[model samples]
Target chain A: MVTSRDIAQRAGVSQATVSRVLQGNSRVAPDTRERVLAAMRATDYRPHAAARAMKTRRSQTIGVVIADITNPFYPELLEAVSHALDQSGQRMILWNSAGPGEYSALQAIREGSVDGLLFTTVTEGAAPLTEALVHEEPVVLLHRGLEEAQCDQVVSDNVAGGSIVADYLVRAGHEHIGYLQGPELPSTAVHRERGFRRRLHQLGMDLRPELVGRAGFQHDTARTLIRSMLHEPVPPTAVFCANDLAAFGAIDGARSLGVHVPEDLWVVGYDDIAMAAWDSFNLTSVRQPIADLAHTAVQLLLERITDPDLPVRHELFTNSLTVRGSTAHTPLDPPAEQRDSHADD
Target chain B: MVTSRDIAQRAGVSQATVSRVLQGNSRVAPDTRERVLAAMRATDYRPHAAARAMKTRRSQTIGVVIADITNPFYPELLEAVSHALDQSGQRMILWNSAGPGEYSALQAIREGSVDGLLFTTVTEGAAPLTEALVHEEPVVLLHRGLEEAQCDQVVSDNVAGGSIVADYLVRAGHEHIGYLQGPELPSTAVHRERGFRRRLHQLGMDLRPELVGRAGFQHDTARTLIRSMLHEPVPPTAVFCANDLAAFGAIDGARSLGVHVPEDLWVVGYDDIAMAAWDSFNLTSVRQPIADLAHTAVQLLLERITDPDLPVRHELFTNSLTVRGSTAHTPLDPPAEQRDSHADD
Candidate 1:
């Protein structure tokens, strides 16, 4: 409840002097500033955020909009982003947009609660919101990108990541392959699918639409879809999942069906989350530089916030393939000899 | 920038009338209210949060203190809490306490940015903070309980859950059982250890301290601890993990040692997270009833926020055991042999 006036009265100084001292203007005399600061401490005075905002036109805060925090991927990204922001002494306000409506991002921006916005749009139909935000505030898109909107973006090369999976499967001699796509709304999914299909066509492999399933970026949904896919009369020889979580579900589903991995059906996933490294699910995946993506996104956001007139920048990081036991296949040249060798061992 | 005065001038009403109309006071005439609202809309008048806070003495916002949003468990809890608060039209301000600092929780409350605080303390030594916040604002503890602090809390029956694991292991004829403990700061861990130890003693089993491993409630840390334990001269036949995440690590550790589950060693985990049912893990765990825990915590927080005079409430929910392949063992007695009447197929 203590105000600047209380500090001013106790320090025997004018209200303007007290304000200058609290703001660290450096224009105030050192002795006077110290007196005011002492009085402020004595009175337990706290500056009102709104008053500070009105004077400086800066909140020193950024809003992070995530689709769902429960998803392991977002949390990892968030931690990186938070650390980056903390280094610059800025605070982050988290906004959850997983609800039924789609206007939380817009609502937060319109309220002018933060100096900038970091949007991780997981679903489609966020074009309007992104467009509106680009016009109103500085925004950096992370993980997911918007095709129709022009804004700063930092994302992993999902297209290349998808192709990496295709290349691996082709080299491993898997002609019959299945694909699991994420939600149709997110641009990441679209890009990955495009790259995956294009590579398959280039390799002269048939792309079966019936073999592909849409899981909407959830583990349980992916599980159900995978269960149905694997139950088909002619299952694909290999399955490439959209993400690690979905791949995990596919792996588990295949195991439940009494199908041996790699031998019966090779499974490859993307993202290469921490769980992918666990011995139980030594998943072969495409690893995205998540920490780098997060750092780039925050850096771009900070630059835009500091200089709004600067041109929008887009930074893309490449993904790499991590080969593990899940994708190990018997060499085709001596398949029978290899089988005999294993039997002899 | 347009203030209520501008709207008053446009609507041909006094500033007092404009205030009444804006606040929707019953005393304001309908026609007058409509006129003021129209004028405000035309001018695009926006209420400054600070001025509104000064007048109404409420921010309609709550602060959520989470240890780590990167943790899958906390994010799930956060999503539930956010949804519950959103239903009441309250916004959440997230403070990630996973950073290297001990006073983040206290600093957040001292700043008085939110109407109430929801604390999820992952470590011990939060007594000073809990004490400081008790007098200043409404604070609710979620998932983790503080025994010395008198505040509204909602926690699952960890002790009972732990006992359930011990009893199940004993019933399965496991003579040597290992305990994997999480960080010692949290009351949940303490209670789980107490229950497990008490049940083991009651069942006439040796509670070996050497078999107990301590991890910081993380998968990697748990994996390291379990790996070292497994390398011992004589490993326990079964291990009771503190949580599902840690349990996954234990499973991974055992798998790396070429030890088949259930056949070679039994593993039972607490908190039956979604991953527990995965074929790779198939972990037997005590279900924490997360949905119920979330609902109870939110309800208690809301009650305290609405009526500070209400007595402090501590609610506990019971947990149930979820038996899966990880804990499958031979029964003490075999089924009747059918008088050797049935022949081999």
Candidate 2:
């Protein structure tokens, strides 16, 4: 039941100034805007988003298109995005793409449905969808980016993450290594593959074409692929999976083949999901700034919403290596370091 | 560009009938409504929710407030809810409560935001939230229900789920058992604990005070609590964790104390999250019909939204035991049988 006048009184600002801030006017001073935001937070004043949207022609809702909600990675990303959006008085309308073909993103982003769009599922062939989406609303690419789209983008440094894994695995003395990847469509997978190969090439090594397999972003598919690869006479002594889920599958496939992780075979994964540190998997993986990536995406989207004339911006977040039992020579990741990387961690 | 006319033609109905169905008018016949829904899905007809809300004062956006989206259980629940809502031509605005005290649900449910709410994180003593939410909106409790709130609710049979675990462990011949529970606020914990203790009493056994611990629904907290329990002079031969994350923690705690899962100590968890079937954890868990629960909750909410005068209803879904490697005797779960439990599983 709190009102803007009450917040204005508490923040020592005029009611008109508070209204201006609520409307996302660019003329307000930074300090004044900060005070108004602080007062709103202190008083728990929700400014009737739908009412405001009706008046301003903005819905105060962000359309979030996720490839799969059940994937642990997307959930983690969403947790951060939700927290950030809540602070700014924006609501998130979530759309799970279900699978590649199960959803129509173009139809979903109809006019006035949301203030903007944050997409986490921009795979390779998604250019047409993004192309159509850009003409309709302000769109921000999150986690996944499209080369063909000229929109604001925030993503993890997949290439660097891949390189970190390659560096760690090579340092651990693994020569015969394999690379397991997700679908070729996802830029995340492509960039990760690029980084891993780029680093291996720098280290005077290469993953032969026959040693790479694609799992189509499925855990079971990854397991089947790894099982076949491990059954060969000249199998890989180490493997680097595009993501942690694939890495878990590789471990299971290795176990079924009577090979122990970090002993007879070493495995590395990307995206370092929460399960990586569990006593069960103890997967060695690359840690992306999930919270930062989400926060930056939301922040950039808001800026674009506030000022449509702003030039398109792309932000890339760095990633670090989290070493665990999955690798032969990597030490166990301590809890304190993980906590230090992200505030939400 | 799929339109009401397209859906109407596909359903063999007039455009007026399709419009009536989209508006959620109670005059539409059930079979006609179903046909309209099917046609809409087939043709990928996505109604502009905001534009519709402006015209009809009924937003097709359901506000979903969850406790912690990072928890695999919640993400799984959200996946089901999103899928069901999509089929019904509605959108989901996700609000991750983050944790206790970080959000106020009643405040978040402003009048103009969403037509209904689907709450997945209702703990005991949340009377104030539901009390305010019910008067302002058509709210349906999903996964968690409040005893004090007169709202439509769909939840798992936690009492029966707890009883199933007791029955299975007793049949497996484990006498010394411990129970690891989530926070006291959640009704699920209370109901689960009640059923577990009741079954133990029926078997002429009881859990001592020292054998019970609360994890506050956190993985690390569970690990610490289980570690202390395991270090006792005489530890339990089996432990029943309220959820899979806690069960994973129990396994880790036991391993730290030189005890092995399914050999020296047995662990059973609830919710049967996707991780339970992984080659790593393979936790034996009670599987709730998550998809059915979500679908039913949305259907109930829609019914209530169409006719707010209807009597409030409650649905309790039965959960089945999914046997996997975490137990001492149960074999690994096969994927085909995994889908046989639920119709849409």
Candidate 3:
């Protein structure tokens, strides 16, 4: 069993340099890398990382459970996590929990194939996650979270974000603002909704129950529901979506009904994803520190792995509002019109 | 061990029905599910899936090697592959081979952690992949290709897609059309370049040396390079990007220089990702049958897993050009102007 120290001693290089060479980090000088390789060959020493796994049950792999891989946000998050894991010489296995493969997903953990699990999505009352808690799984929640779970969590301030949007819409003179709520199971939705409602109350206004819709977190669903909701006699003058995808849906839905965004109905979303900056959507959104959140989650996961009995930790990343064309109150645009269902996309 | 046959017999259902029930496929009736579980408990039969895996040395997991996971196209392809794998009861481990992490990525198979590997990006001179081939790794290529490789491959007709773009641009009366190619290592870039040039040659016009650039396949890179290219004495009237992301870059680049798309410079791209349809880009692109390609790749990998000695296979999927505002040739637009780099995003 050759170790980093043995390789370093044989090559006359530092242990960190030898480890970097093993991980294929490109910072090592070419000549130094050759020396390390020559030493490894001369010593007839195989790294045999798998052998250590047999003794310690560390697979050097982590399983990530994402809610929806199709969403651009999850892929971006996965990319960041993958790069971080690669830096630490670890592999990633993705499990799409949106599918009907929950049994096999849990089995992967129970079989000890992965060292730990990084959950990107865990909603409130996630009964399936109880199995992970029962066995005291090495799990860390990412951006999405579970309020009651006894696990390390790293999340952005959704309440503050929602409040910011609420204040922005009210200041823009939107009295009948609607809310496109994410599914209530996730803490993001619950907290954001609370913040929005609390801000409205502070402004001496109340969010009408009929103006809110707690539907699944999806684009097409949000589009369809928003279109139908807009058909009502007194539609909302503004809409606040819990996430960027929903905001896109709301804008598209409003367009389908011949309603102008910002001019007729203001639209805002949280999580200023890259698409928000595009000239088309130009959605005013709350930007979460995705990179910081992901990096912190990785650090927390590694800490818990080093000490199993470590107390749980909760981290909250701050958020900022990105003002764009979506929420701009322009008076030059025409007034809102009734539904134009015959228009083609 | 509880086999599907025994479960079927005890539950008074077909073997396929019992298997479907175990897979949690919703097609099974409630009564049938109840009967199967009741029978399993009465017979004290447990599905020893892990025991079977131990005997067969099968981890029931496959590795997918992708060039860039952050790219939107890769995630959609991954989602389709995951669903396909789930239908066949296989798991996917992703390998982002974009950076210097190629060594450990291939080692996963060298040590037999995964049953097989599905490569989504294997360039012409990929030395690391040859090592996997030396060990007779069960590998299948998907979407992207290698000019010469001894593995099952699934690729779209990129050459034809390029030819279509060329003919469309030529028919639209554009002679000085530039080509925004991907990195030359992958066969996709090679074949697409060939197809585009061949079509141009058929029209008695070849791609000028000065009109072609092999810049890296990325949005920001394409934008910067295209911006610099547009400043030449005779800028191209149209451009064909290797991928949609590059087309977006071209559009944003052109916009940055106050050049209008379709009116000033027609732009077409490959891989009609969902973003192409957004009102911001409205890009015309070649739509690859990603679902079919992914399904075929999974099938090929599974077949290879069952019989590693099977003869090498190559598959090509047909693609169609999706025309949108980007290629509509709307002349009622402003002409190109000098760039204002100082303008903020």
Candidate 4:
């Protein structure tokens, strides 16, 4: 058990200074704080957070609310958030919001079990977010943001990502394109669709109302949705899915109908997860710096926790296109000859 | 806003009885406790865990330590544990051990931040486990177990699972087989290998030393390991990987060298993760009842925390095989004719 006195000695500082650092006091010099943190790391110091909580009235824990854990994207985001929180010397309490109605994080924060809350997934106008803000709790939103919330948020430029996919497909002469729309409540899905639709209109390739299909997080749901959309009279030559999982489902659904990817159709996904690079999927996707987003969210939340007076901040990261085998080739012209083969469907 | 009085009125019990239930008092009658709990759930009661901690010296929180979150298996396990804890009216603090040297959970438990610790992954003779036991902190091991620990453990029978795989391969007329071994520390890996080797010896088809290769959780690591093993003059016709991820890697590695799965080579994995059922992989794997294992582990830990005098227990689950497309067919004889093309390696 390393003590504050030992940390002070190692960093050439007084025990009082070490205590101040632990309290997240801004009065401490930056260099001195860094040295103290380094010493603590080197000594494997384990601060008694419970004792400190009693004195500071802060639990030194942050509650992270995730809607789903089985989704590969959430796990990746959680890893990043966990590392970031670990660096801030704060513990993370994971709350799975089993449904949109779950408000476990808000209750946990109100009870002082956690000092702040980080919502990686939340719907627009969520009751818990409104209640948390009314109570003046430290809150930060990541991955998803609300349209009319006065809160700190760290997210990617989802609209621009969707627009990029639209432009890529249109430039490849894909006039008949389809979109997979996710649940309507989340700002991420809404903004993404907004951008995609607006861009396709600008490109003189307005998306057909019948081509837009609804999809959930489940692969089977996406498969059924896409299969029904493709069974229409004039099917899409390319499909832009809301996320990587949706894209995988779309590709498999098309293949089940004997449509060859990149030859008969092209598929694009969002959120370039690790599976996107697997030879099995080889999916083209929009890459958001999830780690950077998570780290920034943690930083903003900690700052708000340390000083409640700080103005709300919205940090947006840029998204880029990651091309892969899914959309490796964009034919110059509509293959009338290829279309003849699937005319029956 | 829901209080003990409201709960008492709803359950038709005295407020004192409701308080006893909130305090986890063992003297409360089982029927009374169930009714009080039902009323609490109906009212969406949020107990002040921090305040309760001050009065009862119990945080109503459990610290769960997972070595890696990116592994799909952990997320599934975590979902089950979270549901179980929610039912027990407890919160969960997740600690990503990040590496073997991490001991954050032990420190958190010692400081009364969490009532007990649940280790989903831990090495044999880990220092933190030993110290936690020495300090008498309630602990339970899940997914992985220590050889010489006096702690409650809930795990699937990996030994039997390994033997089943061995028996399957040998019965399929595979004399030359390879094994992809995971990290040497965890009992899940050690015991799995023990059962596999012993069963192979019993069947008179011992695993060759050259065919056994070391791999890690990373897909690329497993790919490189299996590729090198298959590059030998007398490569194996069947390979059993440590986990599903490794099996995917092995299949891809063999395919990269012009060998076909279930034709010239067969691959098997453990854990039977959801990905195993994906069309791209469709891998055969040993299925462990992960949800049951997680729920049982939580129940055991809560019992131990409520009554520290409870004797330690080990709960072992049975494993079954999930046959998929990866092993759809087995030739009547050795695949010598199919192996001729790859013999130059």
Compared with the true structure, model 3 gives a TM-score of 0.81
Candidate 3 ranges beyond 4 A from true positions: A1-46, A99-102, A208-217, A221-238, A250-266, A325-345, B1-50, B99-101, B208-215, B225-237, B254-265, B329-345
Cα distance off (Å), candidate 2, residue B222: 2.0
Would candidate 4 be rated incorrect, acceptable, medium or high by CAPRI criteria? medium
Q: Chain B TM-score for each model?
A: 0.77, 0.84, 0.83, 0.88
Task: Report, to 2 decimal places, the DockQ of model 3.
Answer: 0.33
Question: Interface RMSD (C-alpha) of each candidate?
Answer: 2.1, 2.2, 2.8, 1.8
Q: For model 2, what is the alpha-carbon lDDT of residue B149?
A: 76
Q: Would you list the clashing residue pairs of candidate 2? A: A124-A185
Worst 10 residues of 4 chain B by lDDT: B336-345
- Pairs in clash, predicted candidate 4: none
Sorted on TM-score, highest at the top, how do the candidates line up?
A: 4, 2, 3, 1
lDDT of 1 by residue, A1-345 (tens): 887778889999999787555433444677887898789778887676567657756565677888877768788888888887765546677887743323554455555556777888645566545565646577788988876567888988899888777776776666568988888878788888888888888888767877888976677777777778778887777898888888888888888888888677778888888788888778888888988998788778777865677787888899998878787742223245433533332
Model 4: what TM-score? Answer: 0.90
lDDT per residue, candidate 2, B1-345, as tens digits? 987778888999998788778865556889999999999888888776656666667766677888887888998888898888877767677777733322444444555556777878877657545465546467788888777677888998999888888887766666678889888878787888888889988887688777789976677777888888877777777889988889888877776677788777789998898878877667899998999999899888888877788888989889988887888555332234322322121
TM-score of each: 0.81, 0.87, 0.81, 0.90
lDDT per residue (tens digit) for residues B37-74 in model 3: 78878888766656645655667788888878767889
Native-to-model Cα distance after best TM-score fit, residue B26 in candidate 2, in Å: 9.1
Best by DockQ: 4
Candidate 4, A70-118: lDDT as tens digits: 8889999999998888766677888876343247677777777788889
Error of 4 at B122 (Å): 1.0
Query: Any runs in candidate 4 off by more than 4 Å, and if so which?
Result: A1-20, A23-30, A38-47, A98-102, A255-258, A329-345, B1-31, B38-47, B98-102, B255-258, B329-345
Task: Evaluate model 2: give its TM-score.
Answer: 0.87
